[model samples]
Target chain A: MTDAIPEFKKTEATKVGITGSALTAGIGSATRKEIAIILAVAVLVIGGLEFVLWAYDVPQYILPRPSLIAAALVKEFPLLLPHLGYSMVSLLSGFTIGAVTGMVMAAIVTQYPLVEKVVTPYILVLVTTPMLALVPLLILRFGFGYTPRIIAVALAVGPMVMINAATGFRRTDSAKLALARSYGASTLQIFWKIRAPMALPMILVGLMIGSIFGLLTTVGAEMVGGGFGLGNRLTTYSSMINMPEFFAVILLLSIIGILIYVIFFLIGKKWASWET
Target chain B: MVVKLAVRNAGKRYDDLEALKGCSFDVADKTIVSIVGPSGCGKTTLLWSMSGLHSLTSGQVDLDGERITAPRPEIGLVFQEANLLPWRNLMDNILFPFEVKHQTPDMAWITHLMDRVGLTGFEKRMPRELSGGMQQRGAIVRALSLRPQVLLMDEPFGALDAFTREEMNRLVEEIWLETKTTIVFITHSIEEAIFLSDRVIVLTKRPGRVHADYPVNLPRPRSLETMAGREVFDLMNKIKADIYGMSSMRPRSAAE
Candidate 1:
């Protein structure tokens, strides 16, 4: 038994060393591999699609080739820039307002059960009512400009953020709360110090979901009423049967959606990196 | 010795379930008292009441003659499983109590405390980076940072391996000797109670009541060799028999 002690210690030391080294050393290579795989997959899919379109001699009206879409993207890039800027402004502003209010609503409701009871039904109705349906009514009230589109985006995003952030705020570890209480932490102190940090990852997840919803609502509102944005360009190009430019608008919107996901992911990585 | 901490007829009920029933005990100044009992005997509930984290349905806990209605600054608690904040590094966690009170921590004293607990170099490391024993040591250092008049620990080493638990036992003894702060420790281990405490208080299962209290006459700074001696075993047997006897009589008592 006495002899076994040193051996156990030796093994434990080695195990700790291996894991410690792995954590610091493995990250760069792991991320490199992740990027490599993504690039390889993109190459295979895009190359294969381009070849298939060319081999079948698919016409632009039927389905444009990848090369034609690429040409349209580059040639029409200057024309698309202003519309892209317009869509981005509406998407970001609405998402920011919606997400911030959602967090505030989460805090208020979690703190006061009565407020949650009174507000939750309307939130549920808003969430399930297909928010884009209100765009025409908003336009009729506010006119065919940024106001209706932004409001539609906010309505789509708000409920998702509120529900998610509330769940995160309430899901704190009971033991941690007990520790804080044992030290006589006040309700506000508990909320700020303990609950806020613990809820961060979930809150970020809510924002990510909210941003995506906001993006979709922005596009939908543009399609229904707005005379600007990539969604409007998409309708205009499709009406003229300019399929390459239509696909180009689709590509731009998809890129914006990807950018939204990447932004939230990076923020989550930086702030909510601590494992629960 | 004058009483440093006192519990008077404490009773607690969670709706219909009574966790503690008129439980009472006292610890004199600068002495360690271990509360031992069978499973579900409300040892933790009693400790929480003492810490003022939970209120008793009846009676109160007094620290230096002051009734503990809320968690007092003079008292600190070490919970089971270390309970270190995962988001904070060791140093930040140790200084949390000071942060809560809006007071600047005396860094020199905290640094000294960390050194004593063998957590000197790991101050900047997150809780996840450390082993279980290391995390518990950090927890201990955090509790001791404020120099509380009384320190309450609830099964602080219950989750550790036997070897690590024994090492922690020695660390606790060393801390108690150095600080001479009154301590109320709760555990189910009879040997642990006899090894570290001045007195062992046993409780009956469910709606816990103090079943017995045994004064340990073991000499100070007890080593593992000392714990292996005959006298320790004799006390262990005595407590064991008392617990077994209680279990045997439980059915009859329940019928009444």
Candidate 2:
């Protein structure tokens, strides 16, 4: 009895030790060295782009010289800050509203049968097609103000969140659900305990998508008619043929977009890393 | 022994497919009963029906005279896979049933069960951070922690190797002797069935019905040496011949 028992325990202990160390090693964010390498590569790309433009001396309208754009960025820095802030408010607000409504709808459908019928058809039709075409109608209704623009952002962003989150809710393991049921957990308890955590990876995916779509739609909204924003600057400077300022605004918009993706990427590593 | 769990004329149909037909059996209190049959023989269906995880198309399953319709807290089930939640560590996973039931966890009991299953120090480890055998050990101890009146195991060690399977059988035997929890284990291995069970219930192939029931009448604390005994070999051969449909090989008593 003692012979087999000790050997089994020793082998089992070693097996667990290897896997436990492997888990901590494999999970979480990039290492500090890796982060440094990424940062260095980004600097090289930006500097190389600037150097190429300087060497070429291209005409400003076709493509503003990097020096000019940077100077425009510096000159317009104070001015661009307010406009950038405006676009962010709409993007963040609209994304939040869409995400909240989408998750709420998903929760409702996963819980109740009838609510899915009411919500899914409308969300699917709107989500699958470009809702930007409907922006003109919204503009007509809401008068080119913050109302139409934010509403447009919500319409564009909400459905992906709703669809993915609902799908995620459905993807829970039947065995786990059975375990929960055998323990006499209520439907609400199962939703919170089993369904919700399992649905998180999908929900994060939805948010990542929603944030990207929100940026595009909000920019489209600003282009259509906004009092102040990077998109508004794009229209103003281009029409006036202020190439450097126009190019500078585009640069700022790209930076903000990259920042949103990085945020979600880190979040994915933190929470959903175990999925692999 | 008194009847603890009873399946009465239980039948199951999935749409057009009938998986079980008129299957009936009774498990005596505190005894280990094993069900073995050919593949796709509704052994799982019968077990699931008894667990109240699936609704039977006809007839009823009862636990201590009460009809089992839905999942009850005292009815514990061990699936073939450990099925531990990946996001939770071993401690949380073991404590999950109590958390769901809103009952305070008996920490002492959980630790004791974990020690019994040789998982005492791995409590803080995540499911993904454990080996397959370790994970299954944690799962078995979890099933035990529920302090269930009857534990229904569906091929609990089916995925393990021969050596690990033997270890698990021994672990289960020790737990049963110590706790006296009625267990209805389903398996495909005839040797395993004969070795672990007080009585073995053999079933007919798909649309399964009870084919035969034989009491082991073997002594307690049985070991691997028991499998080498002539009586055990004769029992295994008889059960195997029945399962394989070699009717000519059915055991005739030496006297007869």
lDDT of each: 0.85, 0.83
Off by over 4 Å in 1: A1-37, B248-256
Give the top-scoring candidate (TM-score). 1
| Steric clash pairs (candidate 2) | none
Candidate 1, residues A1-276: lDDT per residue as tens digits? 112121124344433433342112222224678999989999999999989989998787988888889999999999999999999888888988899999999988987788888998998898788889998899999998899988888888888899889988878688899989888889888988899988887788789888899989988888888689977888899899999999988888899888777676666655665553
Kindly list the per-residue Cα lDDT of model 2 for residues A1-276, writing each as its tens digit: 113322234445434433343222333446799989989998888788778877887677888777788899999989989888888888888888989998888877877668887877888898877766777888788886677778878888888898889988878699899888888889889988888988887888888888889998888888877577778889999999999999898888888888887787767656654454
Please give, for residues B9-89, the per-residue lDDT of candidate 2 as tens digits. Answer: 999999898899999999999999999998888999898888888999999999999999998877899988788887688
Q: Considering the two chains of model 2, state its CAPRI-style docking category.
A: acceptable
Where does model 2 exceed 4 Å of error? Answer: A1-40, A65-71, A110-122, B246-256
Worst 10 residues of 1 chain A by lDDT: A1-10
Clashing pairs in 1: none
Candidate 2 TM-score, true structure as reference = 0.87
Candidate 2 residue B67 C-alpha distance from true site, Å: 2.5
DockQ of each: 0.44, 0.44
